[model samples]
Structures are given as structure tokens and as C-alpha cells.
Target: MKQSPATPLPSPKERRRLREAGSLTQAQVAERVGVTREMVRAWESGRTNPRGRKREVYAKLLGTLAEEEEPRRPEVTEPQETLVEPAPPAPPLTPAQAFDALYAFCAPALVRQAYLLTGRRELARESVERAFQLAWQRWPEVAVDRDPAGWVRATAYEYALSPWHRFRPRYRHPEAPPADASDRALMAVLLRLPTPQRRTLVLYDGVGLDLPETAAETEASTPAAAGRLMNAREAIAARLPELSDPAELHRRLTELAATERLRAAKPPVVRTGSERRARFWTRAAIAFTVALIGTTALTVRTAPTHYEPPIAPGAEIQGVPERVAQGPLSEAEVDLREKLRGEMTSGPVRLTPLSR
Candidate 1:
């Protein structure tokens, strides 16, 4: 049977109901259609007829509305295959390459979460950067872990909790920091809690990390980690009045993530020669300081020298000359000297004393 062309269109009340149910508001539809709320209101009320751009926007909105209004039909099942085809082999990844991949993938979400946790742009940036740097260093060990993002979040939280973050001079600027509403709201609540509690809450609830993974990242036992998360949640829940609506908060977070992704995708700026030279000198200085420290440590740890006892004095030595008789000698002494001389001239010398 041939289906007749779809009816002209549903009424504005019907369209509004669909839009509301599908998580869209009149303001959102207006922004998408580039129209004013009053115009949308009028169109919905059937007081003002929409045409051209307005008509086009209405048509698009109605179509979207209709699609959302349709019931979720059950998915059709296909015949079972006797044998499943194996997935294509993945290319092997080097540690550095894998680190870069994971960093790039998680950076947006991490940054957004950091901003939400700290409410400070600079802190968020620093936290994210340090987390990625640490991740890079331990990539070989961490890559095999089940939740790398959780690890990154935990690292970032530690970075946020570092003394520098708490003690650093605050920036005083005319313009307020630009963060989404959700980030602002979340950060306000997070900063009120102690650092450890805040970190636990952000990792588990904000970033969706499991308790064991959170514990591993935070260096806490699983039960302790769970307690922290629960405590954080309760604290936030107590201060719920300060936060915006949950739905609005979610939307703001989504927007922040999108913005970060767009910003990260842009080409990085190239450093000038002077900048490169400065960085090289800084690295060289660090290396020299480390070397000097190592040398000093080695010198301090060496054992001191001590003297040993000298060899005992001997009564007689084989290699020494015997005292010789002086002046004119008796016949016996002369005979002994002659014998000694004869012995010395031969292999070895032997002396005999004469009786008085």
C-alpha cells in the first residue's frame, strides 16, 4: 500500500512537548534556529506565522521533535554466524607513542575535571600537565593497568593538592576567570573540602573512576578510598543549595570538554631561538647541579685512612755487615780475620771467637 504524504505538520503544543521531553528547551531551539524566544513563543502559540528562515527552523525543529517522540523500537536480530571473524591486528605501540595517545585522549576530560575541582584556570592547566608528564614517565608500567585515566586523575589530584597550589599567590585581575557554570559550581564545593577528600570525590564521582582504581592512584587502601569518596559526596550533597541544577551542570561540563578539545586540536606555536636557548640553559644547569650533588655525596661517604703497626726490630740481620777489629791485632785475631775474609770470598762467611 502506498503511504500518503505526511500530514502538513504537528501543532506547536505537540512540538514543544516533544522538545521538552527530549532534553531541549525553547531557548536551545531558538539558538539552534537563530530565532528569538518571543518568536518561538508566538509560533508555538499559533499567533505569528513563521516563513523563510523561521519556517525552515520550525521544519528542522519539528523533524527533530518527531524523531525524538517516536518510541524506541526493539533492535532486529540477525542470524547467528557459525564462526565469528577475528578483529584486525592492532599495530604495536611504543611507550612514548602510547603515552602521547593516552594523554591526547584524556587531556580534554582531565582538564575539564581539574577546572571543576580547582576553579582556577592556571591550577587546572598545571595539574593536567604534571599528570601527563608523570604518566609519560611511568607509561610502561601504567599502560597495562585497567584504568589509565583514573591513574591520570589521581596524579592530577595530587598535583592539585601540592603545597604550591595552596600557597601560590592569587591572581587579581579585573576580569573574572572564564569557566563554565558547572565548573564554577563544582569547584566551589570541592575547594571547601580537605584536599584528600576533594581529590577522592573528583576522581570517583567527577571522573567516574572505580574504588580500587582510585585507591591505587591515591595510594590508599580500597576501603579508605571508598570512605573518602563517600565523605566527599556527602559534603557536596550537604552544600547542594550552592550548586546550579544538575542538568545544567552536566550541560556546562559537556561544553567545557568540547571547548578544550577544540583548543587542543589547534597547531602549537613554535618557540623562538631565544626561548630554545633559555630552555637548553635551564636543563644544563639542572644536570650540572645533580652531578655536583652526586660527587659531593660520594666524597662524604669514603672511609678515612689509618696507620698500621711497624715490623718488630730484629736482634740480628743476615743482610748487615759485622763490626771489624781496629788497629794492630794479636796473632789469633789476625788468623780469625783471615778466615772470615776467606769465607766471604767463598760462598758465605762464618766467624769464631778466640779464647783469652
Candidate 2:
């Protein structure tokens, strides 16, 4: 049977055993084969068989095949498919839509800040609402700023201090309502400070703004802002003797601030397209009426009129008389006398002279 190819040389395990008996590590064999130790282990364990240049190196390292034997080459193949394309992204919202979103996001915070500043619930709501209205009008400008919430809060504070608010018939002094022990205590401390001091402290410490930002928002100098903050702290400290530990008090105050911020946040009531259109029409109608009145006034001013004055029933007509003169009276008289003498009897010269 031609010796049956000698049983394929009893596999690589027998060779690995032979090499191990010589006190060499798998890493040393791997270096000789230009492969990892794990690869060598797999080869020795019969989990894989070396191919290509690796097979040649392995055979040489194990003294099984001659160095002159050429290495076998691995087959190459192409992929059957390609990667899938991704879907397109969604479009961005318009300014009005974005305003609606931002208003919803910041309303509560605004309300809370207003409440803290004024210490009255209704005033706080009014101030916050007015701020949101302003924000809606200037959304294109306000939305581009880095901190929209800060802008809204600053606007709400300004609204709270507006002359309209000051002069409104419904204006009421801000007063803290009855609350639980912790809230009552907090309110008492807050109430003791001046409005500016309280507002500064709340903006800086409670709302987490830095000194410069707080000063800018409050329209005060850095030193003035700092003084207000200090005064507020001192006032609160004096009122709350129980808050002896500054760190603990700060922690509690931060928690209270978080609570206040959450409470103030509320969903905004948005005006629909129809409602906005209605408002536009209403304003247009008023403007049209005013324009009509103005036009009528101008027409009356420029138009001509036929007006006649009244005459008295009886009135004398004043004028001059025509002139008349006597003709050749003297000559006529002389001639008449001569002729009468000549003809004394000439009928008495017809002294009937010319008919007068």
C-alpha cells in the first residue's frame, strides 16, 4: 500500500511535547513563529493549524519541515454587502415656536424669583406674566442670548419695579403669608431686609448668579451689590439666631431656593394662531377708525363753502343826484329886449319867453 503516507507524522502536539521537554516556554515558540503565545497554545492543542508563512515558521521552530519548503498562501475574498445610509435630520423650530418652548421652560423660575423679590403671590404672577409677554415680543433678540432664564428673571424684576405697577390701583404691600415652621422662619428673615438687599441676596445666593451678573441684572455697581448682599446676610442672620452654622444655613437656603425655583415654574398659556389673528384684526379696526376720522377732518379743512350774509328788510339806498344847467339865458334876454323895443308892439315881444 506504499506505506500509507506515514500517518501524517502524529500531529503538532507530539512536537510541542518534545519541545517542552527541552524547557522552552510557549512564548519562545511563538517568537520563533512570529505569532502570539495564545496562537501557539492553540496550535499545540490542535484547536487550529498554522497556515501560510506561519506554518513554515512553526515547522522550522519544531524541526518538522525543512527551511527550504515554501509557505502556503491564504485565499482572499471580497465583502458581499455595503453599509446602510442614515436618515435625514429634523428641521429646526421657528422663533415663535421656540419662544413658546422657552416660555414654558422658564415660567416657573420667573414666578419663583418674582415671588421672592416681592413676597406677594399675585404680584409675582403678574410680574412673571409681563416678563414672558415681553420675551415673546422680543424672542428673536432674547432667544439668542446665552442665558435666556437670566434674561427673563431680570425682566421680571424690572416689571415688578415698573412705574405702572407702582401707580396701579391694585398695588398692595408685599407680605409673607402664614407657613410652616421652616418657611415661616425663612420668610421672617427675608422680610427683615430692605428690598434691594433682599433682591441682591436672592439673585446671587439663591439663583446662583455671580457678583458681576447680579450687579448687572440689578443695575447696581459691584460695591453696591456687594454691600446689599452683605446687609441681607446680616439681617437674616440677626433674625435667625438658630442658623448659627454658616455652612448648614447655606445648605438649607440652597434647598429652599431649589424648592422656590420648582414652585415658580409653570406651563405657559399660549395664544393660538386664530387668537393672534383676531388681535391683529381688532387693532387694525381701531387704526382704521382713527384714520377715517383724520381723513374726514382733513377733507373738511381743505373744502370750499358758499356762505351768504343776511340783509335787513328796510334800508336807505345812499347815492349822488344827476346835474342840469340853464343855457344862454343872458344873450337870449338881451336879444329879446332889443327886439321888443324895435317892435314895441311886436306882441310885446312875446315876453312869454322860452317856456321855463
Candidate 3:
């Protein structure tokens, strides 16, 4: 069997100092390393050592943080000759205990994440619940994944983005939209974006995922995801012009996600096979129609119009208007002629009465 490496991890005490020096909280470090804050605290306190791939990830993430902050590295210490003490063995978590652990730590944050994608509170809750339900069904496989929470999170994001949910019954509250005008405007712009841009922005900004993870979640290449993110950010900046920097936008999104309180709804009744198929097809049709309308609208909005102003009856002809005859004899024309006989007609019109 291939062996896990024996390379040393950062010492827990040293890591804690480094994390603090980087102005990172335990939770932030945990997120960067794809672990829970509790686990981060445990590692910092020397209660547990991250093994295998996790140790490697931890080391790399900490190394990056150290580089960013330019924290001083600790000097190597001489090994002590005294006998080492072995720590007591920890109890293994049963399936239920494991599920509870993952769920409790991840549910609130995942709900916030789902809300960013779906923009519907009940749908977000349902999406998260559906992911957890699947996790419960395959706890064995999930528990062994390198990042179990990441798996569940990816499923939740997919569920939130499912087109069928748009047609599903909504449990919308009267005051569901954000109360702040700026927030409401920002959300309006976000929800209007194409699915790719919205998903990339939500994952990159709202969930604090790095570019690679955002790209993976959106099933896009790094450059493609980066383009989507840039487009989304530009749209947002256009709407929220006060956000002078990307960090401020990220902070605003974080606050917005927290403000989006997604309440749970009662479980929906099971559908028959035919009804399920019908729902799927109906949603597919609606999505297709919406795409068509969006394309047409975009074309119409971008195409220029050539307007022709209305011309009055006596307005000039296409090239040059025909000159009026010198000997015109109509009543109005003769009256004008008699009037022109007066010297005032030689230049601009005058108010003097014409001789009878």
C-alpha cells in the first residue's frame, strides 16, 4: 500500500501565532483549509493533528497566510530525550453522530449560500434540506470524502440552481425583499444576471470560495469563471457605485447573505411518476421560453432605431422644394400679391394694412 507522508505539520502553537499574525480568525483558517472552526481550534490547541491530505492542505494554507502577513517563522528546536506521552484514543463517531456534526456545523452557512443562488428563502431551505437528506442516505461515502461539507455544499448549490424550483410553489413572505433601497437594488441586479455570472459571483463573493473552487462549482474553466466573475462584479459596481473596492463588495454581500433569513417550509407531498415527469417537462419549457425572450429582448435593446420625423404639408420635398410661380392668382396668393405690391414686402413682413 502507498503510504501517507511523515512530513511534519506546523506546530499547533506556532500555527495559532501565525494565524493571529495574519489577522485571521480560527473560522477563517478553517475555511481556507476546508475544515470546521472546531477542528481548527482542536489543531491549534494540540488536541488533534490533521493527517494525510488534510495535513498537506493545512500546511499549504497556513504557509500562504504566513506569506501574506510576512510573519516570522519559528526556529527549529532540539529534540528532548525524555520519554514521550501518548494521548488517549478518541472515540469514533457513529453514523448519526457524524451526520449531526456535519449538519450542525454546516447548515446555517449553507442555507445562506443557497439563498445567494436561489434568491428565494423557502427554496433555499428546501435545497439545503435536500442535500442533507442525500447526505443521510450515503453517510458512509460522504464521511470518507476529503471534504464532506464541500460535497454537501456542492449538492445544495446545484439544488438551489435547479430550474424546476422556479416553478415550484413558493412560500414567499410579504416583506421578503431587502428593506434597504441599496440592498434591494443590488439584489435586483444580481438576480437579473445570467445563471453563470450569478453562480460565479455567489460562490466567489458570497461563499468566500477562491477562484478555482468557484470555477469547479460552476463547472467552468478558470478563465471562463474569472470572466463571469468580472462581468458580474462590473454589473454590481455599476449599480452600487459606492463600493470602491472588491473587498467592500464582498463585505456587502456577506452582510446581505446574513440578512436573508431563509425559513423552513413544510415538506411537500410526494408526486406520482407521471406528475413528476410533467413537472420536469413543464419547467424545461418555461426555461426555454424565458431564454428565447431574453435573447430577443437583448437583440431589441442593442439594435439602433432610425427615426423619421413627421413632415407638415408645406415642408420641403426630398431634394429641393419647387419655387412658387411669380404670377400666382389664387385669392390668398393675389391677396399676398397685392400686399407684396407694398414696399414692406420687399424685406420681412410688416403690420401695415394693404391698400384696397
Candidate 4:
């Protein structure tokens, strides 16, 4: 039998928007449509289109979503009963309130995520706290961010995975593993993976983010992220054959993370700490600048204004005769001295006689 033409669908963005508006995850939609989550992502991204039975099902799902999303007008006949007053809008949230709400909501999950990344309960909590502290310090930027939770998550992940942390005295020793043998083995395998691959796996499998989103957060190309994820899964599956399946792997990861009882500092504490840190740094910078200015001024005041030639050091005269003690004069030296004296007297004797 000849089939009818395929149903016309909306743009890729519209398709994604409809699914999101319906509060459906890509995995959920993929399950309903009998396709892989990657396929769903491709369809939504306009990279490829679904065909045959899946196309019809996807189109129908979108139609239903569109219908549900449309606003229905109340019947005109129902308005004649009683007058009603509209409720007043709630007050806008203060910066502190907004920050607190964000922290409270994201901190718990972030702590768990950090634990999975670092396998250290204390460091996990600390990473989340530090990330939130930084976020609070840059509240204006974070508050206006498209996804504040994502921003904080990236920061926490970066901190947790930093190689520098290994040098810290407290973190130099590994934390104790989970109580269960399976959990211990799983964590050991996870810690063996390279940082990039491990982060990709956690963001994609553990956190349930789509491929592109995972890549974006990990700061890798989509293909690179996919490769890392594949390598990571293979590595995990090699160590624990039971977790070979992606679903099972995800479940195991969740269970592994759940084993840790991580908690974050309260929002007030985080905010106050952040403020204190900022103030300390600011004061230090001001003091440094003031000292620098004073030193410069003092130097200018004490510096010499005119150039003066330096005096040369004294030196002995070349070819000068050395003095010797007087001894008995030689015969020739004595005779010459006497002859010169007598000659002078004889020349003057003729002139002196007439004057006397």
C-alpha cells in the first residue's frame, strides 16, 4: 500500500522548544519514539531528520505538545457569576535572597558531582563552597547568566579536577572508598580515567545533560567529547562487565555518588566569607598602592639634581730620583765643588778691591 506523505514539522528550534515546554527530557522523548537519545538530539539540532515510523510518532508527539501548549480561552458564559480581585504580584527578590535560593538549590547536587569527580568527600564540599564563593563575589555576572547553575557547576568541576589539588597537604592522601566492594571498585576505575574523559562522563551520564551541552561545559568539541565519553565507558566496562550497558553505568554512577553524604555551607556563611575575602584583598591592594606612592615620592625628594665629576686618585711621579743618605763625597765631586767656589771668588776680587 502506498503511504501518505510525511507530516510537516516545525523548525529545529521549534521542535526543541515544544519538547522543553512539555517538560520532557530528550531521553524520555527518545524512549517514547523508539530511538536513541543521540537520534533525538540530532533531530532537534537539524543535523538529520527522522524517517518512516519514527517520523510519524515524533510529529504526532510534537502536535500533542503544541496543543497542550496553546492557551484556551475561558467560556464567556462562565463570567456572569461573581466579581473576583486579582492577586498582587510578589515583591522582587533581593540579591542576597536570589543568591541564597540558587545556592540552596544547586549546592547539594554540586557536592555530589564534585565527589564523583574527586572521590573525596571533604574536597567535594570544599569545591562547591569555593565555587559558590566565587559566584557570590561575581553576583552581578552570575545573576544575569543564562544558566547560573551551569556556571557554578563548571567552576566546581574545574576545581575538583584540578591537578594542583594533589599537591595540597590534606589532599595528598586519597580518601577512603565507599563501604561496598562494588562501589570501591567503581570509584577506583573512575579515578583512573583522565580528567577530561571523567568530566565528560560525569556531565553526560551522571548529570543527564545532552551531548552538546556536555561538550560545552567540558570545553571540548562535540566530537572530542563523544570520543572521551566512549573511551571512558569502554574503560569502565572493561573493569566491571556488569556496567557495560550505558543505563546500568548511569545507575551505578548515581549510586556511587549517593553513597557520599556531602553537604555545603549555608548561603549566609558563603556570602559572608566571600565578602570577607573580597574586602581583605581590596584592603591589601590599597595599602600596597599607598606604600608604592609614598616610596616613589620619597625617592624623588631625596634624589640628586645635578651631576658632579668624581676626583681622580693620586699617583706617584714617573722618573723621580730616590733620596740617599750623604756619605763621604768622591774625590772628583769634592775637587769640582772647590774649583767652582774659587773661580767665583777670583772673578769678584778685582771689583771688590776698589770699593774697599
Candidate 5:
């Protein structure tokens, strides 16, 4: 059974950020969520809040924000080391060269992000590598993008969260939590939060995303995202008060996460740019051929034909002649016939017994 978020509503600031991240106006958000524009404004201004299904609808209206804000960079989530690391010195490089440089720069961080979302080492590597493969496949598009790293990061996270990866053979049975009592307790508490709350907490604190970005990823209104984070943090704090600070909580998770040491995963399936186009054309050609053949067969089956009756070699029948009757028999012929008839019809003549 699914659990509902407990004990908090999102903040107005979170709500506003969600609206902006989604590129939706107050009116549009209000209409979709079954409220007035003023009500939406009130929510954003921290004056009021929707609850229950309406709140969920508001959250869902922001669902496609990730796709909408493609060019914007996600808030910096780099570790202190990655932040201090210097970029390669200025040098002219080909498209492949630049992207390779990019891959080396971003791969480690991206993998870590995936790991937080997936909670498995191999799955994380697979998610990040798959995302990079896609980046390579669309290098031309990635090349011109203002934030290629962000694009890849977004893609990696998308894959990591996919239900497909969860169903992989290795994941069919979830691994037991760490043996440490604290880690086990933390994991148990995190699991108890609603799915959205857990994901929101991870994205905001674990992944170091700002509110708007977290809202975008979680498909929640900014306020809703904030509310989720608040609820999650409060819930965790209730169990472990010393680590009430979100940062401390995240740092502890990192320690538990760092202990996982699985081998690298195989690369995800990625087709070349041309291969995608070729696959589409092949399917289209097959469909057209099948439709043409079906049409031809139907036409032939239903076509009208002129049919001629077949005649047997000797089956002719003769026609009958018209009848011709004499008007009446002549009187002498009639008398003769009558006399013969009387003679035939008469009984034996009686001769009176003598003249007695």
C-alpha cells in the first residue's frame, strides 16, 4: 500500500519555484488543479494551501518541467574535490575530443548521483554509462548545448529512476541494509517516508539540488517539494535528533554509500545517430509493404467479373407443333360412328321364344 505524506504542507516559496520551473502561469496551473488563479497566487504568496487530491494535481502539473527547462544548468552538486579540480588547459579540440574531456570530467560525479538514486553500485555505473553513450550518440546536439553536463546528468538520473532498472535480475531481491545499527535505522526511516518524500529529500540534500530543480525532478510544485523536504527532515530528525541538519544526514549517508564496492557494469545499449534513423525507415518500409499487399489482395477478392454460362455438347430439346382441330364431324360420319357405337353397346338381341 502507498503511504501519504504526513504532518506538513509545502512552503509558498517552493510552490512558486515549481510553477516557474514548469513554465506555467498561475492561471494555467490553477485551471489544471481545479482552483482559481487567485488561489494559486495565494498559495505561492504563502497565504493559503490546497490539500488532498488538489495538491497532488498541482504537483503533477509540474511533471514535465525537466523537459521544459533543458538549457538551464542544474544547481551545482559537485563535491568539494570536483569543485576545486581544474579544467583542461585551453586547446583546440574536435567534437569527439571535447566530449571525451567532458566525459572524464563528469562521469564520476554523475555515477555518484545515480548511486544515491538507485542505492546500488553496479546499477549506478550502468545508468551513468548509458547516459554517456546517449550523449555520444547525439554529440552534435550535446556539442551546441549550453549545459551538456547538465543534460547528461538529467539523463543519467532519469535512467537511474526508471522502473526498468529496478526489475533487473540483480535487483529482483533487494539487498539487506547495512549491518550498522545507525545505517539500518536510517534506511528504515527513509523507507517509511512516502516515495515522493524520499525522492525529494535525496534530490534536494543528497544530490545538492536547489528547490526549483528538486521541484522539477520531483514533479511537485516548489512549495510541495519544500513541504516534502520539511516532512522528511522532520521525520528523520524525530528518530535521530543529533543529525537534524540536512547536510549532516547526507554526509552520514555518503559514508554508508562509500562502503559499496561492486564491479563496473556493462555499457547500456546505444545506437548511432544514423542507426536510429535507419531503424525508423526500416519499420516504415515494412508497414507500407504490408499495407500494399493487403490492399491488392482485397481488391482482387472483391473485383467484379463477367461470367458466361457453359452449354453441354448435345442437350437441345425439340419444340412441340401447334394443334389444328376440324370444326365438327360430318353428319354421315357421325351417324356411322353412332351406329357402330349402338351395335357395340347393345346387349344380345332377344328373339321372342318362337311366336309362343
Candidate 6:
């Protein structure tokens, strides 16, 4: 047999209204539909819709419920067709425009947050600018992010709290304390807290993010985040008793951030700077690669094709003849030789005597 046609359901709100009108709980609907209550709730809230066999079942159930709940009206004979004007579409923003908008909206706040983290006006400005610069470099990823501000904020915070900044000459010494003594004390206390605790407190108490959100942004577990918040608050309260209240603490943080006139650079300037930095690095990389290739080519051209063994050093020969040495004759031996030559008694003397 051919399957029956699938029933159509109304909008999410209408479905909810029909179910409520029929005095049925979500649990009851879920039980009848052979799914979980959360799934039914998701359908009613439009987070998700049922699909496949479940979709047909859900649609049929909701349709029957809608028919039962909706009142029937008497038929009227008139032209039922109505001309409805369509809504105009909004103009799309250019990538540059969208990036500027995001920068303008998030930059100042991020700068303040960085100042709170680092307590250095110049460093704070640098952090926010750097974060925005990175965002511009990765604009495609940043643009599509669900929380672009949070992304920038996290980046700024990371840069601000970097330990390597302490090694920089300019950042070696601390910035001048806030003029107000109370502000000075609060800043000292905040600076004393560990980086993670301070960040957690700022995100939770100052920025008003929920615990889970703070934890996620800080890359900490929820319990760890909570502990950090608790510890930071305790430390702050210990030093400054009046800021024991989280709200009051938040207010003080706001005031502390506002104490300095930390202004962000213009969006266009930031964008241009980011582009310039990217181009410079790209050129540097290309130059490096070309140099490496040239060096390799030169080495290959000059390299010896075959291995040559080194010549061995000379050695002394053993068996060579040495000169025989003579001793000097004494005076008596010389006289004897002269007398024997003069006597010439032998027969051969006559032949040799004239030669002597």
C-alpha cells in the first residue's frame, strides 16, 4: 500500500501554544512521540526540528493538536487573495567596513581590560592594537566568529599578561601609579594576584561573563575558574576591605580602567598598519627563501663530485749507508809516514817517489 501523505505542522510558537492549550506537558508529548523531552523542547524552541520518521510523527501529532486547539471560523465569500509586499534586503557590509565596525566597538573596551591586566597605559594600548592587528590579519576567521569581541579580548589579555614583556627595556620598570591613593592600592592588589586568577576575576566580575563563559575564555575548567575568582576576590578584599562586594569591586574596576585616558588608534590606521606588517613579513619570508635557494644552488655547483683520498705524509727510510768517520793523526804518526816516504826502501818506491 502507498504511504499516506505527511502532515504539516505550524510554526514553533504556534506548536507550543497548541500543546499548552491542550494542557499537555513536554514530557507527555515526548512520551507519545517516542523521543526525549529535551528533543521536544528543542523543537518547540526552534533550536532543532525533528527529521525522518520522527518528523512525520511529530508533524502529525502537532497537526492534530493544532486542529483541536484552533477555533473553526464561518466561511466568508470574498476575494481571499491578498498582495503582500516583500521586505527589502539589507545592504551587505564590505569586509573592511565590517572589520572597522568590530574594531571601533571592541577596541576601547579591550584597551581598558588590558590596562587592568597590565596596569601600564602604553602596554594596554599596544595590547589592544596588537590584538586588533592580529584580528585584521585573520579577518576571515574573526569575522565569522560567534563572539568577535571576546576573541579580541582574549588576544589582548594574552598579550598584556605575557611574561616576556618584563624582559623588554621599556616595560622593565612599572608605570606610574594612579594619582588617587585608593586606585593605587587597588592596582597593587590586582597586580599581586596570579595571572589566571586576575583574568578570571576580571572576566567574571568586571566583564560580567558567566562562570562557564569565563572558564571557556580563560581555557580553564569551571571549578578552576571558580577557584580563581574566589581567590582573587579574597586577595583583593584582604587588601581593600571596602571592595568585598563583587558589584562594588566591579564598579571600582570600571573606575580604575577609566582613570587613564587610554584611547585606541583609528580603525583605518590599525587596518593599514596590519596590512603593512603583513606585507613586510611576506617580503622578508620571500627574500629569505630566495637566499636559501641561491645558497643551495651555489653549494651544489661547487661541490666535489667524487671523494679524493688525502696524500700520506713522508717517512724516514731504514737501510741507507752512513759516512765512515776518520780520526786525526798524532805528531809521531806524521813523522813516521814522512821518514818512510823519504827512505823509499821498497822496489815500487822508485816509481812512486817522484810523484810524492
Model 6 segments more than 4 A misplaced:
1-87, 310-356
Q: lDDT for each of the candidates?
A: 0.65, 0.68, 0.76, 0.90, 0.72, 0.88
Tens digit per residue, CA lDDT, model 3, 155-248: 9888888777545455433226788887787778878888889888877776666676678767889999999999988887787787747768
Badly placed stretches (over 4 Å) of model 3 are 1-8, 11-18, 21-87, 171-175, 261-356
Which whole-number lDDT from 0 to 100 does residue 245 have in model 4? 93
> Each candidate: how many clashes?
0, 3, 0, 0, 5, 0
Error of 5 at 115 (Å): 2.5
When summed lDDT is taken over every stretch of 10 residues in candidate 4, the lowest stretch is: 347-356
Tell me the tens digit of each residue's lDDT in model 2 across 91-202. Answer: 9998767877877767766676676666667787777776776676667788888678778888888877565665666674545553557866786677567778878977
Best candidate according to lDDT = 4
State residue 58's C-alpha deviation in candidate 2, in Å: 53
- Give residue 290's error in model 3 in angstroms: 41
Clashes of 5: 5
Off by over 4 Å in 5: 1-91, 165-168, 261-356
The alpha-carbon lDDT assigned to residue 232 of candidate 6 equals 96
lDDT digits (tens) for residues 1-356 of candidate 6 = 99776556678888898899889998899998998665676678554567778988888888888778678898989977989999999899999999999888788888888888989999999999989999999999999987788889999899899999989999999889999999999999999999999999888777767677789999999999999999999999898999998868988999999888789999999999999999999999999999999999999999999999999999989998998899899999999999888874755533444553
Lowest lDDT sum, 10 consecutive residues, model 5, at: 262-271
Rank order by lDDT, top first?
4, 6, 3, 5, 2, 1
Which candidate, 2 or 3, would have the higher lDDT against the true structure?
3
Candidate 3 — what's its lDDT? Answer: 0.76
lDDT of 1 by residue, 1-356 (tens): 99554335468677677777778877787788887654565566543456665676678778877786788988869866689889999999876567667777777677777766666666676677766666655666789876686677778866766765445457333224445665455556667888778667655555544566567777899999988877776776677654334334344445644454322221111112224555777899999999999999888788456667789887765777778877888999989988887774556556899999
User: Candidate 3, after superposition: displacement of residue 154 in Å?
Assistant: 1.2
List TM-scores for all candidates, in order: 0.45, 0.52, 0.54, 0.71, 0.49, 0.66
Residue 300 displacement in candidate 4 (angstroms)? 1.8
Q: Which of 1 and 4 is ahead in lDDT?
A: 4
The residue-level lDDT of candidate 5 at 322 comes to 66
